[model samples]
Target: MHPSAFLRLAALLALSLPAHAQEGMKQQPAASDRVKEVPSIEAVGLSGLKPGTILFTDHRDDPAKPENGLVPYLDWGRVRPAERAALAPYAGYAEPDYLQTLNGVSKRRHETLKVYVAQGRFVVPRPADSIDLASYATLGFVAKMDPVIKHKTLNPADVTPTKDPAAAFAKRPDRPWCDLGTVCIESRYDLEGKLPLGVKLANKLEDGASKKVAEFVSFQSELRTLPPAETAPLAGLTKIDAPVTGGLEQTIFWVNQILRFGKFLAVFQPMPGDPAKTVVTTYMALAIKADVLDRKQEYARVPVLKNLLPAQVLMGNSSFNTGTSISAGLPTYARNRMTAFADALAKN
Candidate 1:
């Protein structure tokens, strides 16, 4: 690291130490001891016998030197022509653009970056028929986000979004959060019912061997995360119980949230090398609230912060990761969420 960068990071750590110390005064574990738990895509896949992949497909960053060289980041624009052609039909809209920048966020409310994208691929060997395409028709797409409070269910209805930000703030009403001008909440849908205005969608997939057409399912719902609390961060995770779309086998899911918009999909087909096993190709893209990047770019630009903090920062595992800037938080969350979704589909 450059001397200047080291100084900047040191200053940041120094500035944040007092608050971390203050929290310790409350009798909770030391900030460094806290660890948020998240379902790892790899772990989930192995648990259900599935293969998964996560790549950083962001057009803005250099793939040669990802945040820590461990984070999976891929940009649609950066893909080679041949690889791009292979994934084009399925790629759809999951690539990120470097040019948009999403600048002017805090200063002028400018959204310079066209999007903050995330991508993941996974394989579920089970035939599409084994997956519960119908029940997913009314599922709460937010549940699979698998980052904050993690997976709670497929239900979407019975969740009423809170419109009063002040009231939500009051629920936990902790000082550091309000003092910081924001909070994170959890999206936990455990009830069963039809999502408001949700609809069932069907699609056709050709069986490569038989040349026969098969049916696939997708659905949409108006979902709300569980009420705000200290344990799970939900503020801005959704656009006030945003309307989301999802599906099973040949899986797809998209969420429209206030802070971030995410879309992920997996295409299942027979693997060429092994005719008996199925190969699933997956992709996803998303955009985040510009103003956020504006405020936290300093912390996000740090390498150690980006690497060690992605999953922790996202799942709100600890107050420290929760407090660090999460500008590059999507990849870890994406990988885990995609795997969780694939595992669920494999079971159904």
Candidate 2:
């Protein structure tokens, strides 16, 4: 039997064994099972203009545990099988081909959206009474729609009085629909030893006159916390002040700085002749705080308190190959930063 086939057989045998017996069997640990299970939130009717039992857009009226407040909604109406073929050439180490293909196609044509929710203890402290909660949530992904183009043909015979048959034949009308694509959504968060609760919703939005609406939605499973081991890595990084813009630019800047001064080859390596490849992947950390000002006091006179909502980080890999490729180191670097930031946040 082929070595790969033998390995597969061995894996099957090991997995088929009783739980106790399998534990006794010795083998190299499988790649840490960090791959998370995407949840299905839409099937239970969690997405709509109004918030419902499963849906969460109406947080003001329908509040859930802070730790279970987020949801990911995915719309795949615009995704076609052909587009997947166009992406095969670009799929690899840090470049999981399927994910890269999905990302490439998603960049051009809208397909999926991943939302996140918080599932841990959080507090919004106030002067009189503090609001303590178990979860928090937000829309982590938004994709803008692309425009469509249409083509029209004009006839030369209509302009001239000439009765030439050739002119009439050459003036055939032709019209083609301009293909503008849809939107994409992706969310990232740390599993720092705490089982994070999350759900994904997928559906189609109604088509509008100027732009197509999002539709064909589906969501992932229900909220669940991460096991202790998974949450451990997130306990390291320091949480700094939220940046002015919550976009990926700030994270990119920080990763670039670490690459330049930190000199950590295991985390980052500069690609010669390519400026874009030097950026390491960094997770976007987000915190939501709520404050109620006193009417009797002036705006500046009121005290402000901080509340750490469900922290979310947008995890994306940067290509060192001039946008052509990605490396494994990007995620490794991102995880390290998340750990450090989480640690710092806990301290503060």
Candidate 3:
């Protein structure tokens, strides 16, 4: 049976028992109380399941701590900004111009190169002076298990927080259900709610069927609805109508865009050939709309994410082939820029 379902059953069992009979037994909190604290659209209880029976635990409230009750190495605040920035550029934004120096070529050759070598490679030409806005949504996966926490053995200053950050994070730990290996899974929750967004992209890539790839690309195009909060503003922008081409390249683009504009969330790429594989890998991102340049107050409100320590389940060999998986940290320049933006916005 699905671990989530099992968890629900366990929770139900814990709840259904007589109060007097349960008095000697461990007292489980009421479901409503848990829900009020967690504030999730989805609800699940897994107290009845034996150790190791539960799959995913909801950890949205406390990313640093494990949902199943383990202490994690880091929390969301420590890692979110970096991950968002790493995922940002992949969304179909204009790549910055590269200044190349021709050591061996003459002035004439350099001029010639300029005519042919327009700034960056043209997978798609960015809209001139305008931002492309697409409707975006996100689905997060939560785990029920607690993470094993690791603290720095040495302290920079012989000081600790009067209050524990880990305890603060775990205060309201509820989220959409996930399995042991997958925690805090983020994806484009299709606005129409008809198709599985990110999973479909992974499946098409794995099948190696070009025709399906094209269809998947088309599906993404259809999924470009307006974000719930920013629909009117996004509708005013020019919509790019070109069909997204390329295999993984197109997939990466869509994923990146979602990260940037939708919710500033990052997603894990599946293995080269396995469709079922959905593990968060490297390449974090930071995406901000051009308009945010002017609206300091709105931009300042954007949250800073840091200290992203993914669960152990996210680590390990790819299910597809035992190839070396890719992981990346946010670029220094990108981090600096985002921090600057946030700082400027705050000041303004």
Candidate 4:
């Protein structure tokens, strides 16, 4: 990244520090000693939402109440024979091949990364009255990535389908990732996660434009390896994988694919005991500059760094779902880009 870009990003982030940004003369523990905050399901809010509502959050998990019993949403069993090859790249970040084969700008830089996890929930209308929420929310919408970005343009042709991630990324992207790294185009994706609707739910709605809708819902995104720092805190997240009736997975890129960025795993299921309202749990771990994670430093040499820092990663709606939008990371930055996403999912 250019030096000037970093300055702009640093300034943007300095201004973003919430009024309550943590500060204690470096009283905080070392990064390794730190813990991943996994908000409880209760704090996530389980009730009192009107049907077709999209509730979102990037709140920290309550460490004191430690959540436990979380396994991958589409653990080994959920994988099928054919999908193994196609999903290898998206789910194989832990393997040496992933880093070894990384090409273009998305290659790993060995920077200290800070991962963030967040979730969103909403209720499907009882009568299933609305646009094709599944199509809008899932994958294969590359041809229709409208209303997503403000300055950049992506060619649907560049988004070809292939199971081999190593090969795909090895090839150069025909388009630029962002405009000078400003919020102009906060983030982009390599693989889009899909949360397929079950027969019970699919039967009620009109499937949208993507013929790939069925695959999107069933396609589950996952991580092959997570830093111990991230996993240790999640060991007790018992309900982390709960209520996951269906799953999807995808990976993202930023700043001209300068970094592999991160991957996203999400699950969709009926709210326990409440068949009408559906819940979505999205988990993501991003590779962020540990320097930027420093609340006290002026660490923004990258143009788009302000889009999301270690403290508040921008995942969820904008970058993870079917397609990146024209107004991604917009309306707000700290929160997961779910507002536009919710608007798509909201039942009519």
Best by lDDT: 4
Candidate 4: which stretches are off by over 4 Å?
1-39, 42-45, 48-55, 59-92, 95-109, 127-134, 137-245, 253-259, 264-266, 283-285, 291-331, 334-336
* Model 1, residue 59: C-alpha shift (Å): 8.2
Provide TM-scores for the models: 0.38, 0.18, 0.16, 0.40
Q: Could you give candidate 2's per-residue lDDT for residues 1-348 as a string of tens digits? A: 245544454444434444543232112122223221123212222111121111111111222232232222211113322211111111110111111124245332222222222111111111101111112111111110101111112132222112333222112133111111111112122222111111100001111223221211111111112233422332221121111111111111011101100111011112223322221112221111111111112211211101111111111111110110011122233333333322322333
Model 3, 162-272: lDDT tens per residue? 123321211212321121212123222212111122123223323443223111111010112222342222211111122111111011122222121212221222222
Q: Give lDDT: candidate 3, residue 99.
A: 35
Could you tell which candidate, 1 or 4, scores higher by TM-score?
Answer: 4
Q: In model 4, what lDDT does residue 322 have?
A: 27
Model 4 lDDT, full chain set: 0.33
Kindly list the per-residue Cα lDDT of model 1 for residues 102-159, writing each as its tens digit.
Answer: 3443222223322433434444565433444345433344444443333333332221
Better of 1 and 3 by lDDT: 1
For model 2, the local distance difference test gives 0.19
The lDDT per prediction is 0.32, 0.19, 0.21, 0.33
Per-residue lDDT of model 4, residues 1-348, tens digit only: 355544554454445433333121111122211112334434645554445444444443332211111112233224322222222233343222224323344545333433343445555543222233335333333213333322233333333222345434423234332222111122233332221111112212222322221211111121122323423333123243333344444444432321234444444555566556555544433333344435322212332222223232222221112223211221132223443344445433
Residue 347 lDDT, candidate 1, scale 0-100: 65
Looking at candidate 4, the ten consecutive residues that score lowest on lDDT are 215-224
Ranking by TM-score: 4, 1, 2, 3
